[model samples]
Target: MLVVLVHLLFYSCVLSKVYKLQLTHKAKHIHQHKHHKRQNSASLINAQDFDFYVNVTVGNGQVFSLIVDTGSSDMFVRGPGCVSNSGDNSCECDNMLPNPTACVLNTFDSSLSNLSQTAYVQYGSANVNFNIFSGPVLFDGFQITNFPFGSAYQISGLGNSGDGILGLGFNSISRVAWATGKDASIFDALGLTGRQQIFGTYLSNFDFQHFVNDVVGGEITIGGIDNTKFTGPITYVPLISESYWKFNISTLTFSFGGSQPLYLGSSGGGNAISDTGTGQIYLDNSLADRVNSFLGGVYSNVYGSYVVDCKWQNSKIPMIFTLYGVKYSLSSSSYIIPYNGVCLSGISRNGADGHTAFSNFGQVWGRSYYTIYDKFNGRIGFAKAV
Candidate 1:
């Protein structure tokens, strides 16, 4: 079963001042869902891990959990009768285990909302047709009024894990089309208006000994970076592109037992993008093959991943990535995931679409560093996480 969980991120226009906001961490879980309701009773596998989300109150008092995405630029929630409105009247909602409450949260009421407009978005095989409505969105003690969001009337390919997405990216890629013009992202609506235009993320390591369901230790700061979560001076890298949090990785290498390091070739030295929504790292097929060869990995048709010897899980292999002259290292424990008594390489082959994406630095690189996305400065900062 090969499950590809799609996650997103975003970039916003520049802002004026700097402000600070505290963030809360949302834990991840693996769940099974039926692929087709009537046709096939087989399960659709989800390869990606659950993303980080935050709780926010919408409308009068409708509280829902939404994924904090940096690769996308629209926010929406599942509305009542969404499945019926999905063009294909025969389509039914996937049976989500534990009955995700986030999926069934109060749907946006256009009549009750201050403003309403039509909108649409496509995410990870899910096409959402919705209505954009303005309401007061409350996070912590801060409140923003007339905040634009989507009430999904038609949706497909979305998992039941999260109610919707909170896009932190630029408005250029926003799918929300207002009656008059484009819709501003929540970050742009808040951060560009005399408030701080920066946010930080820290995804904690998952400890097996103290494993707990629905519990995560990571956090995201809205207005500013958290000084307490990181140590040492932060290294800033200029953004190569504002499409995503895109940057350049100068070098990539893998070293085993302190021997000579093998240079990992990334097309054009790798045009990398950082995303909090995606799990695992996706490399070009050539690069992926190189990594698998170095780790003595064998392709598993069952999992569609390169399975390595379980002994490698405890080995001292290290993968290093250099960005902006700064080197970040990932140990064996960071790049290898233990599954079914075997260890699987975290690096996977990118699609053949010809777009080179060093995907999902989270869990591995993110767990080791505190990352800050500075939209105002058009740069990304990293520091050793505490």
Candidate 2:
């Protein structure tokens, strides 16, 4: 009996030691994961996704659409369908053209090709095709030199989602640069010597009305922020990580009146991905219905636009996107665009598998947040305001 008792005591001691070690190891892993996640969230925003809209004139006094994007510098348009300045020969755009309204080059330069049917370019997803070309860039009453540009595959609905997309993100985040060998972007051409190249852009009031007209051009000042257009003080956030360009978010809390502030994705390693190319905010689908319920379903999504009841009124829901030990609120107006004073613009879902740009994806933050891609300033800032 004495021998058995001693043996039992030894085994118990050993088991306790093993359990302690296991607990210590798990704690360390949890700490490491949280630290790494925070770093990723901060770096993601540093990636640039800015683009500008423009108007181009074709034959018979017809004006078409164009956009300035650094991601894709090369510009191309449909050779057969679109109107041109004056020639009927095989479509071509050259520097020496008399009118200078040259179409983007359609030649298959091996150096610039990415995919066989489509040119592989980077935007929302990895390893995809982007249509690139060159055309005249007109901004703020100034006709800058004709530069390279590009577009994306068109979705059938969405009320004519413009002719194409103009990428303005930095080369680090651009797919256009990888597809085409042309490294120099419009920002580089407009460089001001010592300062980082800058472009200033302003959207015309008409664009909000959804009509095709000459772009009353905006300023795209590279290397600096356009103080005239943005009135509020800029909030600067650093890009600390790489590859994904994500940063560490301390917390993301949302509140509605007296209810306890709901912590979003605190568990399961949840972090918000900011994308300008995406026109809405995307969250985990599981959280979509919960968030929408909190917002009172402000906009009924139809054809990708919000149709709200003009007399609808609900408690102002506040979403605080916290990063790098700081917090910024998603303004009420930004989250909910009122058709008049009561009706909301819309709320849509966003995701790759079953989500969309309309879901709590791009428009969530894109509509309200004044995203400052100060690549030149070396920091990205988000501020909430009217």
Candidate 3:
């Protein structure tokens, strides 16, 4: 972990700061954009599986909405002179921000601030290349000075998720850094450590009736955990890796119609990461095939996902994930999503690397349960969200 401590004396006093911000889940249908051209054609388009974002004000009170992602650790926004792959100069910003018109119309000027460095990051199907600059950042009412962030000059495949991203993962994964080779995340730069290194997420389930009216749901607390968002005892699991919120799982099984439970192989056990950036659960191909076979799900070349029988939408089948001796069950209603009158499995095949990734779509597990990411101790906690 790279830690950069810049001491600034204001009236001969040092500052220690903590902050809390509410996150809202923006659930809406996907719209075609210039950036979408860079993403995979098979990417989930009809599903409501984007990330949650919080309002943040960067330098000079220029506010921007940023996705609060635990899977990545870096912060960036489009800057002046940004152009699309097709050489289009107009970068259409998402309307979710505080002032979309102002944000889209204006850009960050590096001439007025200290140029710290330059960076490039690869996220989802997007590549973000930007200039690093240090300035004041405000979250809620807390303010941090000389905070390093990226001013994107080039980007792709961001979709309409959010204006930018607020990476809450480990600082080691941060792409913004000084030329001297030291890297520090936004949290580290703000000096949030020790017991204050805790944060919680409460994501809301998708409601079909009032789609446009209910886009704002869920909450994210920084610097401390929100006890009110969860119930029952929190089950804390140690992190297996520092890169992402990687953790261990004992077993995975599924039960259907009161039938015998089928045990999926444990080959990819203890090697899973909880990611808020992605929309669905990605398991190793072998495990994914087994689950799909049992669910009568077939790979659709049109959607690039497994489509199961729509009748199973109300089935009693439950997918269970046992972690740290605690069994978390995801009801059929939670794992199966309805798209275009067809039912699609929330579970997807992992990459060739064979690592399992539990994402926000699978976070139907979190919908019924609250999740906590403890950066101080490098652990994750879960409790009933009710």
Candidate 1, 1-386: lDDT as tens digits? 11122211111123333221222222333221100000000011122333555556676667565656666777776676666434442123323321233454354445246245776676543567777766677664456676677777776655555666677677777766334264557565653432366777776655544543434346666555667668998998888866678776656555555556556546434666666655556666666777678788986656546898878767876777655456666777767776656677777655545345443354456656788888778888888888
Model 3: runs farther than 4 Å from truth?
A: 1-49, 86-91, 95-102, 105-116, 178-183, 250-270, 352-362
Sort the predicted structures by TM-score, highest score first: 3, 1, 2
When sorted by lDDT, best at the front, the candidate numbers are: 3, 1, 2
Greater-TM-score candidate between 1 and 2? 1
TM-score for each model: 0.76, 0.55, 0.78
- Among these predictions, the greatest TM-score belongs to 3
* Reference-based lDDT, each prediction: 0.56, 0.34, 0.57
Question: Cα miss at 198, model 2 (Å)?
Answer: 5.3
How many backbone collisions does model 3 have? 0
Error of 2 at 287 (Å): 2.5
| Residue-level lDDT tens digits of model 2 in 1-386 | 00000000000111222100000000000000000000000001101111223334322222333333322333334332333233322122222211223343233432232232335443333222335544444332223344454433321111121233344545544445556554324444344333343333222111223422222222333434334445566666564432222333336555554466666544214434333334334444445445556555633333233344433333454556555545656645445534323344333433435442222223345435445544444445655423
List where candidate 2 sits over 4 angstroms from the true fold.
1-52, 56-63, 67-118, 121-146, 151-159, 192-221, 230-232, 240-250, 265-276, 298-320, 324-327, 337-347, 352-367, 384-386
Instruction: Give the C-alpha miss distance for residue 138 in model 2, angstroms.
Output: 4.1
Q: How far off is residue 253 in model 3, in Å?
A: 4.1
- Residue 57's C-alpha lDDT in candidate 2? 37
